[model samples]
Structures are given as structure tokens and as C-alpha cells.
Target: MILTELFREQLAYFKDINYAKEIEFLKGFEASEEEIKEFLEKISLQKD
Candidate 1:
């Protein structure tokens, strides 16, 4: 898969598991809580 797709997959998995590393990684991206939530929602919709 492309890098962007791979990232989103990993993000969705980590977020689902509430993994600590996910928080640190997202912080590296300077992602806000709202942005994270929005991304999760989008991925979840695609899954359904």
C-alpha cells in the first residue's frame, strides 16, 4: 500500500487499541484532539 494508506491503517489500529505510542506519534505530527477524532471517524465510516 501507499505510505498514506499505511499510515491511516496504523493510526486506526493504534487508536482502536488505545496504545500509548499512538499518542506520542500523533503529538509528533502536532495533531490536535479534534483532528484525531475526525480522522478516526472517517476511517471507521470507510470500514462500515
Candidate 2:
């Protein structure tokens, strides 16, 4: 899928999970995985 659409998918997924730290535990990310990882990373990092 297009990167934009992938990002949108990530953004749309913003609310379903309650914990951001959990996303960072994933690895071997290629495309959409970063969107999710980074999104949650942003959330987790921002709390500091």
C-alpha cells in the first residue's frame, strides 16, 4: 500500500490500544510497522 495510506492506518489505530510502550517491543519492521512503532514511541517518549 501507499505510504500515506499506511500512515493513515497507523493514525487511525491511535485509540485502540491503551499502552504505548508495548509497541516498541516489536522488531524487523519494514513499512507500516514503523508507523505503529514510532506512533507509540512518540506517545511513550512524550510522557517524559
Candidate 3:
């Protein structure tokens, strides 16, 4: 799956489980740690 689609699915999974932290979900992606962090930072910013 594409990065954005995967990210959205992960976010849905976390929401379903009421997860407070997203780092673990981000780790599930096939991306480098830095890339995951950058993506997470972007998502967080968009939420604010």
C-alpha cells in the first residue's frame, strides 16, 4: 500500500484501540525511523 493510505489505516487502528501514543503504529510502516518520525511530525502538525 502507499504511504498515505497505510498511515491512514494505522491511524484508524489506533483510534479503534484508543491508543494515546502513535509511535508504535508508525513503526509498523515499511519506512526508516527518520522517515516515520518526519511523517508523524507532519500528521501532528496537521492535527493542530
Candidate 4:
């Protein structure tokens, strides 16, 4: 699986358990503009 997919899976787990602090922690994870864009795209695909 791709790195983006990995992050997507993690995002889902936190979202499922209502982990607000985890979400904040994740938000703090610094990524490049390209990485952020790619990660968001993967997350969007998972939502469908």
C-alpha cells in the first residue's frame, strides 16, 4: 500500500473513535504542500 493509503487508514481509525486530540496531533504533522495534497486526495477516495 502507498504511504497516502497508510495515512488514510490512520485517519479513519481516529475519525471512528472520535479522537479529537489525535486529530490535532495529526494536524500538527508537518508535510510538504505536495504531500498534503496527495494525502487529502487519498483520504477523499477512501470516503467514497
Q: How well does each candidate superpose onto the true structure, as a TM-score?
A: 0.40, 0.30, 0.35, 0.35
- TM-score of predicted model 3? 0.35
In the predicted model 4, the residue pairs found to clash are none
> All models: lDDT?
0.62, 0.55, 0.52, 0.56
Which segments of model 2 are wrong by more than 4 Å? 1-31
Better of 1 and 3 by TM-score: 1
Q: Which ten residues in a row have the lowest lDDT in candidate 4?
A: 14-23
Compared with the true structure, the alpha-carbon lDDT of candidate 2 equals: 0.55
lDDT digits (tens) for residues 1-48 of candidate 2: 466555555554555767556444446654466576787656543421
Q: Is candidate 1 or 4 superior in lDDT?
A: 1
Relative to the true structure, candidate 1 reaches a TM of 0.40
Write model 4 residue lDDT over 10-38, tens digit each, in one string: 65333344434522336567666457556
Q: Ten residues in a row with the worst lDDT in model 2?
A: 39-48
Q: Per-residue lDDT of 1-48 in model 3, one digit per residue for the tens?
A: 366666654542332454366544454565665675567656644531
Give the alpha carbon lDDT tens digit for every residue of 1-48 in model 1: 466666666665444554455455554568777787778867744631
State the displacement of the C-alpha of residue 4, model 4, in Å, after optimal TM-score superposition. Answer: 19
> What total of clashing residue pairs does each candidate reach?
0, 0, 0, 0
